[model samples]
Structure formats: structure tokens, C-alpha cells
Target chain A: MSDIVQSLEGLLERLHIDVGLRPILSLVILLAAVFAVICAALWGAVRARWISRNTAAFWIFVSPWIVGFLLFTGGPMVYSLVLSFTNWNLIDPAKFIGIANYKEALSDPDLGQAIKVTLTYAVVSVPLQTVLSLAVALLMNVKVRGIHVFRTIWYLPSLVTGVAQAVLFIWVFNPSYGLANGLLRLFGIEGPKWLFDAHWALATVVIMSLWTVGGNMIIYLAGLQDISKDLYEAAELDGANRWRLLWNITIPQVSPVIFFNVVTGLIYAMQTFTQGYVVTHNGGGPADSLLFYVLYLYQNAFSFFRMGYASALAWIFFVMIMVLTALVFRGSAFWVYYESQRPRERRRRVHVG
Target chain B: MSASAKAPTVKAPTVKAPTAKGAGGPRREPLGGRILAVTLLVVGSIGFVYPFLWMIATALRTPEGVSHGGVSLWPIQWRWSNFTDGLGSFPFWAYLRNSLLSTIVPVVAVVFSSSLVGFAFARIRARGSGVLFAIVLSTLLLPQEVTIVPQFILFKNLDMIDTLWPIIVPTFFGSAFFIFLYRQFYLRLPEAMTDAALIDGAGWFRIWFSIYLPLSRPIIIATAVLQFMSYWNNFFQAAIYLTTDRWKTLPLALAGFQSVNGTNTPLLMATALVVTFPCVLLFFIAQRHIIGGISFTGSK
Candidate 1:
């Protein structure tokens, strides 16, 4: 290996390539070499009639994803699991520690705080965001004039990038002269220090989460647009009031969409990092109230150089997410209604008769 | 019993009827209810739009004007030089160039590779394809945080840290979500379109490039728009990889600026606006495709 590398380096030097560009050039060359070998093998297989033309074409097309999956995602995932059992700080050599990191995690108060904060944020924000976005979607679903303009305005805030949103909201929630307190002052009420007060810090983040409810609102609008008009008309003919129509027909009709949004929203909310990181200037805001799970994991890995411990934390988080996702999916069968399932139901009824 | 036999046929029109009308359901709402909804929406829009107006106003204000200003939309004095000052505060142009390079390269790379893979997944039949596609879908649920550490280590070993390569190179492999989008789109295209080309002895690659790709303008645009927003707004990987100012992107620079100049409210807002304007412009120009792309994931 060393001899080949030395020869390659000599060849590159003879070519007079710049030092900074040498590594990238070598990588390209390596990838091309691998591609050549794979192509040759594939050609051999096709000539031998071991595989069909369509199979060869399929492999060629999907090679990028297969290569990328192994290099970027699959390999790293397995490496992360291995790292969880060892002590490596990015500088020194790694030493096998045999689950010491996980053992320590059991007694770690910081991890506990991080978990508590993350769960609270996800639990509080997910439901609130769901309800608020649903309400806005319902309002936007009506055939009012110029509803598009209102929709554009509502979604404009969601377009702001996370860092910019955090910076803008820092001013908006400024204790004395910011917009939140400024608006409150107009109503003869003094607002508490948001993003600064420990008691209100997480709550303030929850409020900030609602600003992007337009994202989910659009999805809900799509779901509402999908509901059959016949269901509403039938309900009305049966003396169903507006509330009854909404509760019975509309909700059930869109239940699958609701399930999707809630599952995705909860998963997203659990991984909160950017807002807290930006608002608190890379610290846990106000007595660790903003010590989100991912943020804590980040600090452990990058700030404190505890890569192994961070890997353990990441694994724990993975399991938590898996469990939560499974529970939601398992619960979905009870509540989510699929229009396609009606055929099966009808068949079953026919058999019963 | 007969109705039960016809249930599958009955389902098709009902599913598509509301969508054909361009709006769902009858507007049986009374005038009073309509007026109330319109009023509430207008009021709520002000709340949603007020912060942005305030941001622009504050960005245009003098430092003292911002400190003394109440909750007002109008600036006391328009300080146009704040933008220039903010631009000059750091290596703004260099960072902007870096940001464009990182974002644009990834956008083009992801679109090309994803569409290629998606076409194969949707159109071609091969053994083990089903399992491979399932693995691709499963990766969507894997939080990026789990892989960040080892990815950093991988880049570090490759001597690609502190450069844009770490951010740009991986995108060439294609992203899962974009591949899924392309797959969903290609699956809907009639197979006969490709069959004709194949019967004429055209290769699968040629058929995909000549026939399928031209028909895929909508998906391409939608993927590009969505990918552009994500790569441009990306912060986490940029923060980890680009540790040096030599190749820092705009968001990373902005974060550094905030830590140093946390108290410079006016200049900060001006800088933040500079970083934010492109995304807002893109959203307005391609919002139909953006919303369609998002809802496509939901409905499917």
C-alpha cells in the first residue's frame, strides 16, 4: 500500500499538480478506476449471459445511490455503533472501554436534563403546531376572495432559514424594545424576559415553533381538498350540524394525513437543535432550559471532545425515536381510515350475507 | 351485493372529482360566516407579516433609532449605509461565493443522480431491487445526527475538512428523499412512452435521457427548488466541517458575526436580511412547485 502510494505521489509531482488539488485528483482517479473495473465485470457477466441486459442497466443507473449509501450513511452508522463502545476524542488513539460510556450515561444528570427538555419541547410543540396549522388550513380552505394572498403571507415566515429566524426573533423578543414586549406594552401588560428567563425559555421556543405552522397547514389543506364532497352532503342531509360534520366526516376522512403529519412532526421536533443553538449563542439558554438532546450530544462530541460518550447518547436517541415511531405506527391502525379499505370491507360483508 | 362488486369502479371518480373542480366541497357557508373568516384571516396575516416589515424597518434604522424605537413599522431615519457596513463587517463576498458554490453544485448533482436512480427504480425490473429500494426508504427516518460524528471523522481522514468538498462531494451520490420524489414521478409516466424507444433498440440510458427526462421538467424544477432551499439554508454540516474562515459559508459567517457583535442590532438585521433574501425570492418565484412537492409527499 505504501509503495503504491509513494509511486502515485511521485507521478503526481511529475505532473506538477498543486498540493491543495492533489487529494481531490487522486480521489477522482480512484473512483474512475473502480468504475472501470465494475464496468468490465458487468460486461463479462452480460457476455456470459449470467445476467440480463435490463439487470445490467439497472445496476448502472442505481450505482450512485448504492455507493453513496455505503460510504455516507450505512458505513458511518455501523462505525457510530462501534464508537459507542470505545473512548476516542478525535486526537488520541481510540481505546476499547466496553460500554463504560453507556454506564456513565445512566448516572448523567446532563443527559437527563437534555432528555427532559427535548421531550417537553416535542410534546408541547407537536400538538400545538398540529392544531394551529389545522385551524389555519380550515380557514384557508374556505372560498374567500384573495385567499392566495393570505396564504402567501402566512407561509412567508416559514421560508426564513433557521439562523435568520433565530436572529430576527432575538430582536423580536428583546426584553424592553423588542416586538413581543412592545406589543404587550401597548395593551398595558409587561412581558417577561423571553429567551432570557429560564421559566419562559422553553415556552418561548415553543411559541417560535408555531411561526412555521404554515408548512403543515399546506399539507392539511391538501388533505382537506382530497375529502369527497359526497360525504359532507350526506352528513348534512342526515341533520348533521357543522360540528357533527367536522367531527364525523372531515376528521375521519383526513385521519391518515393527520397521522402522517403528527408522526413526522414529532420526529422533527425531537431533533431540535438550530433554534436553541442560535438563540443561546451555542450555550444551553438560561440555566440549561434549552439543553435539547441533539444540542447536548453536539456539545459532548465537538465541544468537550467526548466522541464516544456522544455516540452512546446518539444510540440511545436512536432507540427512543424508533420506539416512538413504532408506537405511533402501531396506534395508526386504530384511527387512520383508508378509502381503499372500503373494498375489503364490502367483500367481507358480502361473505357474511 | 351488486354495489359491492362495483365498489372499486365507484372509487375512481369520487377520488378525482373534487380535484378536477379546483376546489373541494360546496361553499354552503353563509355570508356572515364568510365575512367572519375573511376578517380573521386578514387580522392573522398582519401578525404573520408584521415581523418582516419590522425587520426591514430596523435594518434601515440607525443604531440609536433602533434602540429607542417602539413597535413601529416606519423608520425614523433610513440608514441605507447599514447594508454597506454590514457587508464590509466580514469577508462577505468570499463567504457568499463559497455559499453559492456549495449550494449550486449539490443542487445539480442531487437532481442528476437522483433522477437517474429514480428512473431505474421505477422503470427497470431486476432481482433484489425491491429490497434495495426498501433500504433506500428506510434511510429517510435515520436522523443525520447519528452519522455526523463518523462522517466528520471520514472527511478528516480524507484531508477534506476545512474545505467545501465535504459538503459538496456526498451530494453526488443522491439524497433519499429526492430519489423518492423522482421515483414517484416516473412511476406515473406511461410505460408505453419508453417501450417504443426500447423496441427501436435504444439503450435504457438513452431512453431515460431522451424520452423520460424531457417529460420530467416539473419534477426536475420541483426538486431543484426544494434542494436549492435546503443546501442554501444548511448550517449543521457547514458549521462542523468548515472550521476555518478560509472557506466558511454565509450562515457560518453570520453565526460568527452574531457571537462577536451580538449588540449591533441594526447591522445584524442588515446582515441577516442579506443571507435571507435569496430564499424568499426563490420561494415567491417557484412557490407552486414548492407547495406541490411538499403535499406530494403527504398525499402519497
Candidate 2:
């Protein structure tokens, strides 16, 4: 029996394949061992003697997030970072490629175009959406009869998913069989083939996108609500017209919300994927007019199987957003208003104190 | 253009407004102003609602009735068969069942998991919690495409490809963005209720369930509704992971119908409508939840 056991061990070692139950068990044990180490570290910082009282509560709260971070963020993030240094397809062993992928991505014309289009989309859409949302919110704030119903109706489009909403727009923008054309025909003017015409496609998409301004509108409404009614009443008594009131009281009060929406909206618009994808058959539509930054990254990563290059593109985008956000933050001091901010002369005394 | 710089000028006008209203007892007509306001609202509402109405109209049209020009308020012929034909065209029922499974399970998982994580960040000041939160938030910036390859590789290795596991599993971990939203909401809640629960010998789980869950209904409903729609509208993940026709969700099914066959316009429109119908129905049903959801995250 001893001889047989020795021979079996030798055979398994020679084959390099773990045929015995012990090897498999050991592998499982190794995995558990790693898990235990992580759990122990977390507990030590979270609930152990050295930790603070809220450790367990914090750990317990974060427990659900751990799995997501590990799987979605930690694992994939590290994997992709490593991947950005390699040449790997879906199945192939990743070949070590120095900075070739990074170089290629920088030089890619499609990527350049994508960046331009994405910036244009973000630049145009974010401001437009913000203005429209504020305008609509202002309109809804009035004491019109059945205004609540109108508010609900206006907000309807924003609640619908991007896929459905874009599909609805696509139908309306369909060159041959769309309502847009029909409406144009009513005026004896031919509608430009909106989707298929490269010149008009991106613009049309931007216009279609503006229809769902309701999401930001609701936030503006909340901000509007927070503004004291006394101010508006005061404005009315001072003979301030509607535009003057909107320009003065409303805009200043809601400027912070507008700033928030602008940053978020720009990020969202830059990464506009679903509309570009679904409308253009999983690619940017109509001669790449809708070739959004994230869409291009997606195409490179999944469609073209250029994982490393796509990673580079993603990092570039991340850098761009960071810079843009920082710029916005810096610039915000010039535009955004806080109700707590007193007059400029008063602000000096408060700051000094 | 510091907001404060512009404040004083507007402030003066508003202060004068009430006195003016008293002095001028309903002056002669500002008829032009009222007409302009009415016209703007009417035009805006029409623009907002028209596409949705057109979607309905197109879905109602027969093959012969599908004309680009001459779209009217009413369809020339109401082809109700389009709905029936759409339902009959493919495995529509199966798609719905699959969508329910895909959307509901993941939504429940995301809400439960993200909320739990959110509560930790909001309530507990554990070591590394801030760092961990920052790391998680960073993931929000890494567009989903960046990680799709590795995840696909991981799923392939796990033999979970072609299954709903890909869509369902990640959601169980909790989304960083949603968790952030929930955390902000949780932070704003009064601390007294939590302390009372602790005094009553309620365990963490018990407090979270019995007190926090009930109190956070608005955010919970909003998150759930949003997550439900997220799963429902998910395209690339479904498109990549689900190969078999039986496994297709509504978006994938609808996309397939558009691309695979030639110009069968009526059938295509019908299929698209069916795919979109649930979301629209959901929007109407949960309209109140929508506003609440936006408020929690939109301003922040």
C-alpha cells in the first residue's frame, strides 16, 4: 500500500496533471486561504480590537459593495491595465506588446473623429439640455390650471429608457416613412433625409435628444421649490416682468443645480452609446457622424478586438473628463450661486472672520 | 458673472414689484405677453408629445398604409393585426418571460446590495471605507466597454457564457453610482431612529430591514424602478452574452428583427412597439417614483 501511494504521487508529479483528489482539494483550500486573508484584514480594520466602534457597521454596510468592487472594479480593472500592455484577442494568449497599442490608438483617425464628435455633442447637448430644462421648469412653476398634468406629460419621455426613446425618435426621423418628412411635406418643403444624410444625422440626433429634457427639469423644479415664494412675490410687487424674475431670482437660485447638471450631462453626452449604437446598427450612424467617444472605444474593444488600444482610448477619455470637470469646477466660482453667499462687500467680512 | 454680482440688481427690481402691484390696480391689457406664454407652452408640449403619438400611429398602420407623407392625427386604417402579428411573429411571450427574469432578479439584487453598501459608507466610519468608496466611484468613469473583454473572458472561463449569469452576477455586487445615490440619501436621514433601534437591541440586519428599509421607501422605489429599466433597456450585454434565440431579451429581440430580415416594415414596427410597450407602461405606472428617483441623484 505504501509503495502504491508513492508510485501514484510520482506518476501525478510526472504527468503535471492533478489526477488525485488531494490536488483538487488543495487548490480549493488555496482559494479559501486567500479569501480568509482578505476577510481577516477587512475585519481587523472594521471590527477587530484595534479598530473603532463603527467598524462593524461600516464593514456590514460595505459588504455588499465588496463583491462588486472585486469583480467589476478590482479584477477587471487590473486585468485590463495588464491587458493594455499585451496583444490579446478573446481566446488568444496575450502577447507582450510594449507601447504599440497606445501608439496606434493615438494615431487612429476614427478615434480623432470620435473625440471631435463627442466633444461637439457634449458641448452642444449639455448647455441646450440645461437651458431647456430650466425653461420648462419655469413654465411649470406658474399657477396654470392642469399644469401638474402637463408637468407629468412633459416628463414622460425622460423616464422611458434610452433604447425605447431613441427608437421612437428613429421612427420619427426615418427618411422615407417618418412623420418629420410628412410635416415638411405639409409645408411643401422636402425634409432632408435625417438619419441617412451624414450632414444632418448628428444634428438630428442632438435635436431628438433634446426632447427628453424632463429629467433635468424635475431637478430644476426641486431647486425652484426650495426658493422662497416671498422673493417671487417681492419681484411681482417691484413690477418685475416674467423674464426679469426668471433672469434675476430664478437663474441665480438654480445656478448650482445647473452647474451640477452641466457636468453630469457633458459626461453622459460624451459617453452617448445606446442611441448611437441602436440607431446606427451597433455602430455610429451615417458616415460616423454619431461616432461618439465611448462608442468608438466599444467598437475598438469588442468589434475590432483591439483590447489594448481600446484601453488606451478609455484612459484618454478618463483624462479628458477629469480635465473638463476640473475646468468646470474652476469656472463654476464665476457663475454658480449659493443662497448663503451674501453681497460681495459683506462676503469679505465673513471670510475674514 | 459671479451669481452674487448679478444678485443686487435683480434684488432691487423684485423688492419694487409688490409696491408696484398695489399702485397699479390691473392696468390695461398686456394681451401680447399672455399670448406669447401660451404659445410657447403649447409649442413645447406638442414637440414633446408628438413623437410618442407618431410611434403609436406607425404601430397601427398596415403594410399598405405605411407612407412617409400624409401622416395625420388618425390612421387611415387601424390594423390591430399588427399587434397580433408582432406577438405571433417570434417568441414574444418567451422574450417577456426572459426579460422579467433578467430585469427583476438583477434589480432586486442591485437595490439590496447597493443599499447595504451605501448604509456602511453613510453610517459607519470604518478604516479604508473612504478609500474603498473612492475606488468604487472611480469605476463609474471607466465606461463599461473598457472592462467588457475581461469580463467576457472571466464568464467564458466560468462556463457561464450564453446564460443570464453575466447580466445577473455583476449587479449582485452593486453599482457604484447607485450606491453613491443611496449613501447620500441615507446620510440625510435623522440619526435618532437608528439610535433608538440600537437601544432596542436590534441587530444591524434587523435595523436595516425593519427601520431603514421602511423609511427609505421613496429612494428604494426609485432605485428599484431605475434598475428595472436599466436591465430592461440593456443592449450590448444581452447582445454579446445571449446567442440562442430562446435567450434573447426584448431589446435584442427587437434589434434582431430589424437587422436579420428584409424590409417587412409592418412586422418590424410591430416588434419594436411590443419591445417598447412594457417600459412605457412601467413609466406611467411608476410616474411618481420617477420624480423621487431623479431628486435623489440629479442635483448631486
Candidate 3:
């Protein structure tokens, strides 16, 4: 038993010293096994006589996605989990290294800070965005002319992304010549160095994120549109004040949308990568305040070729999402008001039925 | 339900409209208050819009004055030559072509595949599709970062490392988001529309193509425009896949320009504007569909 174990260890070390080819060969073998399993499933599905059973159309429609799922999503996820257990750069043969990657990840100082920065971004951005978007939507929901034009204009910033957005924002936040400072000059308020100062840098990103509130504004506007003016008139007739109507009617009416935005916004915030990356030229902000989670992960996987460690990081990220989503869904019963419980919703359902 | 709330609050464009709701049992707001409200809104609109206009104006200015231009809304010295100079920074036309090619192929593929699966999930009553649809919905939260390493390796194995195939092939499969959008649309479609076609002995393809496809022009266009904009603006995907200058998309090229001319503000703005204008123009032209698509929900 000892001799066998020694030989195995020696063989692994020898394989580890080999360049590129063995890892690629191992991946190809795995790919072949996956392909064989996929072929068996397809064969079994075909043998079920879906055509005669009248479900062939469904399979045909969904076939592309099933193949894609096997290749891209499910297969990769499983492979990544396996990769997490092995220490291999693309250039080296992989060797089993149990729990080492996750252990390293937990202790990695840069990763800990990155996680904090990401959380700070999410904690700051999500609630502020929810409130601000609803506020803007209420403002725009007025029965005024040309509101559509304003709505489109407000949405423009949200649509402006990628290199254009990054470059434009860098200019907008430039201390000496940026519009933020130039406008501040008009008000006799000097703007702080944004994106340059660590204290203000994450705030700069949050502010940049606010520009996209027009997206949530549109969703809220849709919800608000469903609230008939008659409800407001009735509330007023009942001696309900403006604030009372806003608090009681408008807030409840828009709560579902607000919930949707919160969930998506939280997810988007956790995965914040591109703008921060581009703004800092991928080095991260001053004092590394903008060193977000995914940025670090990307650097690990690609720049450093620490694929095993990055896979571990990816697994942790997936778990975080799963936990957060589960928690939100569990907690949503208290906050997310479903209209279906109301008589009006029942009437609408009846009409549809 | 009411013909229209004839209250002055809605009819009158005034600042004091806020108070019109329960203002001493019924009274219109003062005209000055209305003017103040409109003035505030108008000023806020300027703040929202002027930067884009400023971007366009700055793009036309000579490189020297933009630094000290003090956020001028108009070009001090119109140097249309900046556009030409900006184009000279890299292989601009090639990058534009690459962007168009990458986006166009994916747009076509996404539209075809999304609607196909959408039709299956929404229309065909088949076993296991519910589970499939649920999987699609849940995976919507799966971040791309988790798969980047394996995806890179997979493509590397396929010898597609530097090619456009790595970027565009996935779209040939359906995207979950668009599939969901199409499924929602199909599910909400009037049953009579499909039932009547079925009575005429239409096959699945006939129902989807002859009846549904023609009627789904708005959605198809909306999906196309959105997909094109995303593909055109995609930085992360391109950064991972394309290494050679020959195949770099416009966004990557724009980033390259930013790196090369880090201080040339006007040239950078010009290049940025040129790269982004197509998406803006698409949005402007199709504003209705884009907005309507977002606002659309299944309802009575």
C-alpha cells in the first residue's frame, strides 16, 4: 500500500512537470465522456417517440438550448468544481490538491478587501437607487406633455456604457477640467477629486450608477400607470392628504417593482466589474478602494493563471448568490406585497379567465 | 375609469399643483407656483441632457482648448479635423467592421433561437418544459465570471482562441433573458389567434412562421436592437476572447485609443462619440419599442 501511494505521488510530480499537453489531453478526455453522456440522453429522448406522442416539436424547439446547456453552462460548472480541487495552470499538468485553493482564498488579504469593497458598493447603491428611481418616476408620472421626451433623455445615460461610458465618466469626474468640478465652481463649491481619492472613489462609482436610475424609473412608471387617477381622486375625497395618499397608495402600488429592482440591483452590484476596471485602468482605484470582487477573480484566472484558485473563488461567488437569493426570497414575504391578494387583482384575474 | 380627472391639479401645468389635491377643499394653484415647478423640471432636464450635447460639441473642438474649456456647451473652435485624426489612432474601419460582424451574426442567431425556445415553452404542452423553463429563470442570476476560465480553455481547445466564433457561437443557442421575454409575449398572445390557425390544420412551423413571426415584428426588432447594442458595447467578452489587433471590436479599439491618447481629451471624446453614436442612434430611433419592451408585463 505504501509503495503504491509513493508511485502515485511520484507519477503526479512527473506529470506536473510536463508542459501544456497533458492538461489539454485530460480536458479532451473529459469532454469526450461528457459528449458520450449527451449522446446517450439524445438517443434516449429520440427513442421515446416524441413525434408520435406529439412532443417532438417541443424538443426541436428546445434542442439548441439543451446542447448549449451541456456545452457552456452545466458542463462548465461541473468542470469548474473539479478544477477547484486540482492545482493547474493551463501550461502545467494538474495534480490533486485538496482544499488548498479555498484555504488560500480565505486567507488571501487582497481578496478579503475586495469582498469588502464589493459589499460596500452594493450596500450603498441598492437602497439609494430604489428610492431615487421611484422618486424620479413619481415626478415624471405627472400628466404633463412631452414627458416621453424627458423619459428618453433620462434613459440616455443608462444606455451609455462600455468604452464610451468609461471615458466620458473619467472626463466628467476629472478634478481640473471635469464638468462636476466646473459646475461646482459655479455654485462656489469645490468638488473633491473623484476616482482619484480613495475616500470618494467608491462614492464616485455609486454616483455613476445613479445615472442609470432611469431604468428603474421606467419600471416604476409602468407600475404607477396602472394606478388609476380615480384612486387618487377617491383618496382626496376621503380627506386623505397628499402625503397620506403617497405613502399609502403609491408606495404599495409600486412595491413589487421596487422588490424586483432590489434583487437585480443587488446582483448587479455584487458583479460590478467593467466600469471600475476601465476607470482605474484595471489597476484598481487609489488605495485599492475600487478593487472589486470580480476584478480580483478575473486577474486571478487570466493574468495570474491561477485557474484552480479562481475556480474556488467562482464557487464561493455562486454560493453567495444562491444564499443571498434564497434569503431575499425567504424574507420577501414581509415586504413584497402581491396585488393578487386584493379584490381588484381577483377581478382582473377573473376578467382574464 | 373616469372620463379624466377634471381637477386643475392634472390639467393645469403649475408648481402649486402639489397643493391642488386637498387645498382647502378645492382650489387651483397660484400661477407663480406652477411656473416654479416647470422651471425646476426644465432646469433638471438641462442638467440631464446637456452633457451628451456637450460630448458631441467637445468632439468637434481642437485638442488644445478642451482642457480649459470650462464645460462649454459649444465648441469654441470647430475642428472637424479631430474626427479624421481620431480615426487615425488605430485600425478604426477594421474594428467597426468587426463590431458589426460580431453583433449582426449574434443578433440574427439570438432572435431565431430565443423565439424558437420561447414558442416551445409557451405554446407546446410538453413534459419537462416547465422544469426547463424554471432552470432558465434560475440561471439568469449565474454570473459570467464563474465560467470565464473554463470558457477560455474550452475555446482554446477548439482552436478558436483568437477567432470571432468564441464570442458569437453562444448566441446561436438561446439566451435566457430573451427567451423569457418571448415566452411571456407568446403566453399572453390571444388564444383565439392560435386556435383559429389550428382549426385550419396548421403545423407548428406554419403557426410560428406564418401567424406568429409576422405579428412579432416589434419584439423581434426590439430584441435585435437590444442585442446589437449589447454586443457592440461588449467589453468583457471581447477582452477575454480577442487578443490580436486584427480582430478587436470597436469597444476594445476605443479602450486602446484611451490608453494611447490618455491626455488628448478632445481626440478621446471624438473617438468615443464615434464608437458609441450607432447605439445612441439605434436607441433614439427605436425608443418606443425599447421602453415599451421594458414596461411590458402580462396583464388583463
Q: Quote the lDDT for B155 in model 3.
A: 74
Note the residue pairs that clash in candidate 2. A235-B14, A236-B17, A237-B16, A237-B17, A237-B18, A238-B16, A238-B17, A238-B18, A239-B17
Residue-level lDDT of model 3, residues A167-268, one tens digit each, is 888888889888889989999999999989999999998988887787777777777766656667788899998689888887876777777888888898
Please report the TM-score between candidate 1 and the true structure: 0.94
Evaluate residue A181 in candidate 2 and report its C-alpha lDDT on the 0 to 100 scale: 88
Model 1: how far is B34 from its true place, Å? 1.1
Candidate 1 accuracy as lDDT: 0.84
Interface RMSD of each: 2.2, 7.4, 7.0
Q: How accurate is chain B of model 1, given as a TM-score from 0 to 1?
A: 0.91
Superior by TM-score: candidate 2 or candidate 3: 3
Where in model 2 is the C-alpha error above 4 Å? Answer: A1-48, A233-244, A340-347, A350-353, B1-35, B128-142
Model 2 agreement with the true structure over B157-236: per-residue lDDT tens digits: 55456777788878877888888887887777766666766777777777676656655666777788888877888887
Clash number for candidate 3: 3
Best by TM-score: 1
Off by over 4 Å in 1: A1-11, B1-23
Which consecutive 10 residues in model 3 chain B have the weakest lDDT in total?
B11-20
Q: Is candidate 2 or candidate 3 better by lDDT?
A: 3
Per-model DockQ against the true two-chain complex: 0.50, 0.26, 0.28
Regions of candidate 3 where Cα sits further than 4 Å from its true position? A1-52, A343-353, B1-37, B297-300
Q: Is the docking of candidate 2 incorrect, acceptable, medium or high quality?
A: acceptable
Question: Compared with the true structure, what per-residue lDDT tens digits does model 2 show for residues A31-108?
Answer: 456557766786777555676656756765676577556666668867777777888776687788988877887788
